[model samples]
Target: MQAQRQLLFGMYMDAMRMDEVIEHCRTALITRRPILLGVLNAAKVVELRRNAALRESLMECDLLLADGQSIVWASKLLGRPLPERVAGIDIFSRLLLLAHKEGRSVAFLGAKPDVLAEMLHVVARRFPGLKIAYSHHGYYEAAEAGQIAAGIRESGADMLFLGMTSPKKEIFLGSYGASLGVPVMHGVGGSFDIMAGLTKRAPIAWQKCGMEWAYRLLQEPRRLWWRYLKTNTSFAQLTAREMFHPDHPFLAGANHRVTSGSPMLPDAQLRSIADD
Candidate 1:
């Protein structure tokens, strides 16, 4: 848990490690204050600039984690370096481990019907002690959202994971997540496909080199090539320009290399951001 807040690329980012995230998830489960976690990547940073509603919704999150290594690299160049990148998919797995260890009830929302069904099997096999309270495929009518929320609320799940796509996932969580009454919720786009083994994650080597986006492009060129090329190029160009700026405040700070040490955000603050 880290107390000091740093402004990076116009957003406030929390300085936390993986352990802290798991601890927070565990705490939220008992506290009834669900935490909205945003996984900020290079592409998402670009998306935030273009999508005001999405950005605003995400900005209201309880914690904004660096999902892309580029963000960690940028934090260094800016001089207030973050401890690490908290990859969304990685955190998703870890929280599941926590739930399984504690025997917590969980719920699933989003993804195609078959994919969601398959993911449920993967979850069962991987975490045998964990209980899935309820689940629904992502193809519901807009009118069904209230009913979905009611079902999730009634399920008594401590954690809810949404595998829906952008804007819709963000919007749904922002608008109705609190009403669903889950203590911890995360929007994990397409992680179900990976869990279902329909797609593969980047090899550890590529991930370590910060080229997972390239691997994704290699796998789905038609869908991701142009998106990654445009976002990565823009991110690089913008980061380079900021890194060299003489008057950047972070560059002038004396103590920039902060490692794992500090306290956590307040409950009220966390609750405030939990809403949009």
Candidate 2:
């Protein structure tokens, strides 16, 4: 069964609940068909306006989910209500459990070496039955991406999770995801840190109220304050424009180059942008 997609903020977001997403992933794994999952938050929605490469990479995704409650609220305000915020961390955890229960092997890429090790340790204790096919730190040089992708392909993993930040994760997947032979690929930014206990997710109250960004700002005010301010303000403005001027050209979706069983971008270009 195909989930309904709602076009909001110039992108088509799958209006799927958590259970549906998990079932879709299970089917993808069973069928051995690739499902490149992407997610959008308020910051990403704002970034899409200026980052052509990011926008293109995201458009290539087979499923795009609202990762921020603000995005869900925006959808409701725009008359296209999404089911809920499918936070990347939540989905990552669910997929791990699913893989464990199904006796499927999974691969993990990204995060610092130490953090990756800690996360793997935690995963082993939490899901003892899950098989880890391959694991790699996110600090490899740009030229090493091919070797990394090859390693994942050879490991015979059913699902691959990337804990790197965007648009690096997006670019890497855009360049090499088709060749990796992984049925399910998810870019789960910062989830490694959370799993390793290096960072804490906001309380459920903060998440429900769409104040998770504020909680993050409180966690590291010096580094995140400016970023949140700029992106949040831009997102709010963009949301207002979409709500008030539904026919505006600026709100129109771009000519997206969706994935067609091929790499989204050339290796050279994707690597160059990823290095930037």
Candidate 3:
């Protein structure tokens, strides 16, 4: 689990492997702290630069799962290969199955105004007895953050899935978790759109081939082309640099890397950065 938390610009190495994720799902069923699955992609790491506080906030989560194939490839190149890519959609469905079996309830907190309502019906029909406590579209103005927090508190939801993008979800979780007492807070980018019948996941073959990003690009060419243009390129370049430059601080002194043998980075350097 610790092999992944390098400081590459506040990017998190995902903690749970596929088997571990399955185990955690089962554990959450019994323990009542619904698991918070964070899907980290290259774009999200880049987006972190805009909000320093949000990076720190995500660093405090119970778990972060690698949702992007690039991340898995990076870990492999770094000589710390992860077990598998745990996509957000896959984890969501896995959790739902666990919830169905355990009779646990869940709440949806982000999506288009009517998307959550539609999702509730779809999910309820698909998984009998799955309870949905409350849901809201994630279009609140800045002033309404507090009100949204209050709404979460009032809902008594066990697992709150913030279907917003990075920093937004992290900000919401870090701000609201203290008062709301929800056990899990999942940051599911675009999952609501998929759940609300607005988009489709790539085929299992495509996902397994690690071409899911390509499929998405084909689907939403105009909206996502620019985003992919920057993030994908930056990630590829940065990852390559890390592969060649072992001395880089981002890879050397990351928080999540498990330091088992010779240290990946000098302990003093790591301690200093961590102190700051």
Candidate 4:
């Protein structure tokens, strides 16, 4: 079957659908093809894709998602507004729902033992029909990774969720997913704890306002301070530069012109959503 395509900002793609993501995995298993799910938070990881090597790898992927509202807005400016933001957590839930409906199998590898256990229970209870092929608690070394990879291969899991930290999860997926025969893999950083009720998501209002990062910093100041400081500072610089300059580097010739929004993008959108 030919994959359906959408014209996105300077790119062509299969129109991203939550259900179709899971369906693609099923199809890939039957057809023995490789597919990638590249999730992007435009403000956070957009710079990562600027590297020539990284950009090529991401574009080579079968799918990419505007996982952040900032990315959606950027896409609009780039002339390819994403149909919607595909939040990883939400997509994770949707994938489980589909797996339950179809009786497909899954395995989770990574996150602390307690987090993974509780998350597995929560997922199983939420989707009674879904099968958990297996789970291995996180905290493995490079040498031990082989064992976990072997376990996933042996379990016959159709989908795998790796809760390891950034680059690590991405590296693992890029390196081992095809060889392990898991057609669908998602890097869900720290999500197991949130999904398991061991940790809480920011309130919806805060998230909508893009202040969830603030709520998180309030909760884990010591660990997140420097990271937040760096990213948020870079975020502010990017926003300011883009807002003031008609010819900002980020806004070059991609999509809809973005000179009309408020100085702060999220605040601008929050105000608009509130008015609605």
Candidate 5:
């Protein structure tokens, strides 16, 4: 379970490669231990500044993957470069294929009703023999979170993929993910929409050029244009500031001190997840 990690802009991001992440989940499934997974991107990183709960939830996760190209670039500039970007969508797709090959059951939580149905249908079509333990749309009341969690637990799923938004998704998982009893749980934001064919992913060229955000901005300018503009700028400024002032409190290596045999540091942030 030991792996390299870097504290970037007050967030702990896993430096594990995609294969390492996949192997970790596979191990979690076999060992029956819950590994809450989170994906860090520019927008999510910006939100972490204002949302301590979100930050704590992410810190608690057993694995944190860099989902945005911007995050990968920032990690490099900060002098603790991640091996590569482990985009959430790519992980989701890869896990589905893995699940099919291994005969592991999965549960899906979140997305609109229509989108959820279409996504399930598409998953069925594409990944023949894949087991869908359970599915629910994201329209439920907050009060129903416990019931939803219970349903997922009862399904005896090996993996659970949540397609909800930021703080809500993180909070829900932090609140009930452990009790849900799923070994591999991940918050895959908006991936269900793309899986259902209701939304288009960026073209290969845009993704390769790290202009996927620009492509996304072009796709839904009214909804996403300003948001990305603000987040990208803020991330750039924050990274620059951190680069100059490397002694910012998050950079202090108190918890990162050498342990008995493992390189992994115990996280104080995850312990504070329920405080919010």
Candidate 6:
């Protein structure tokens, strides 16, 4: 399928709805075609600007979806509105249900050892009949990645979920995704913690209002306060630059013609620029 992508924050953001993403994964699983799924949010957007390796890894993804409500809002403000936010945790849950229903096997590769075990237990209870092909904690050294990837490959899993933080998950998948042979690979970040009941997701209202980050900050102020402050401020500045400065290098070579509430370049032009 031809991807409908928008150049948002210097990345090609897939304009895919939740159902479309699920269907794409379904097709990939059936065809044994690999899809390295990447998700972007305010924090990641800020980090990518400074982290060349992480940026390169994310750019290698076959699908890149907006994982933060702020990203969707930014897209609209920048006149390249995405359909909606496809949060990583939501997709991870949906995929688990899909795997359970289809009797497909999945592999988990991240989280503390006990947390991983607890997550597996939760999965078995919550998603009975969901085949677990392999599982491991995220405590291994960089040198052991090849062996771990080899084990995942031999597990015959249809999907692999990494519970590690970025850019560890992104870099690992970028390095070993093809060799792992999994049809669908997703870096789910803290979804495993949520599954294990070690962390709580923000309420639906907070999520809808795009205040999930604030809620998270409230949960762990010391560890995340400064990080969120720095990233959120940086992301807001970046978005503002794109909004007020169309001639900026990030949006270079684009004709800023607005049509139907979107200031997107023609599809042909976007394709040409993406090719370069």
TM-score of 6: 0.88
| Per-residue alpha-carbon lDDT of candidate 1 for residues 95-134, written as tens digits (9 for 90 to 100) | 8898899888889998889999999999999998688999
Clash pairs of candidate 2? none
Please give the lDDT score for candidate 2. 0.82
Please report, in order, the local distance difference test score of every candidate based on alpha carbons: 0.73, 0.82, 0.64, 0.61, 0.79, 0.81
Cα lDDT of model 2 by residue, 1-276, tens digit: 678988887788899999999998999999999999998887677666656777778888999999988899999999999999999999999999999999999999999999999999999999997899999999999999999999999999999999998788988898899999999999998899889999888898988887877787788888666666656676677788778755222232465332221113223322322100
Best model per TM-score: 2
CA-RMSD of model 2: 6.4
lDDT of 5 by residue, 67-152 (tens): 88888898898898998888888889989998999999999998899999999999999998899999999889999998999999
Task: Pick the winner on TM-score between candidates 2 and 4.
Answer: 2
lDDT of 1: 0.73
Give per-residue CA lDDT, model 4, range 117-190, as digits (tens): 88888887888768899798877788888788889999988778877654456566766767787767776656
Weakest lDDT window of 10 consecutive positions for candidate 6: 267-276
> In terms of lDDT, which candidate is stronger, 5 or 6?
6
Better structure of 1 and 5 per lDDT: 5
Error of 3 at 85 (Å): 0.5
How many angstroms is residue 92 displaced in model 6 relative to the true structure, after the best TM-score fit? 0.5
Candidate 6 residue runs with Cα over 4 Å from true position = 1-3, 246-276
Q: Could you give the C-alpha RMSD of every candidate to the true structure, in order shown?
A: 9.4, 6.4, 8.3, 8.1, 7.6, 8.5
Q: Write the per-residue lDDT of candidate 3 for residues 180-237, one digit (tens) a residue.
A: 7666567676677777677777888988888888897798788666666656666566
lDDT of 6 at 101: 94
In terms of lDDT, the best-performing candidate is 2
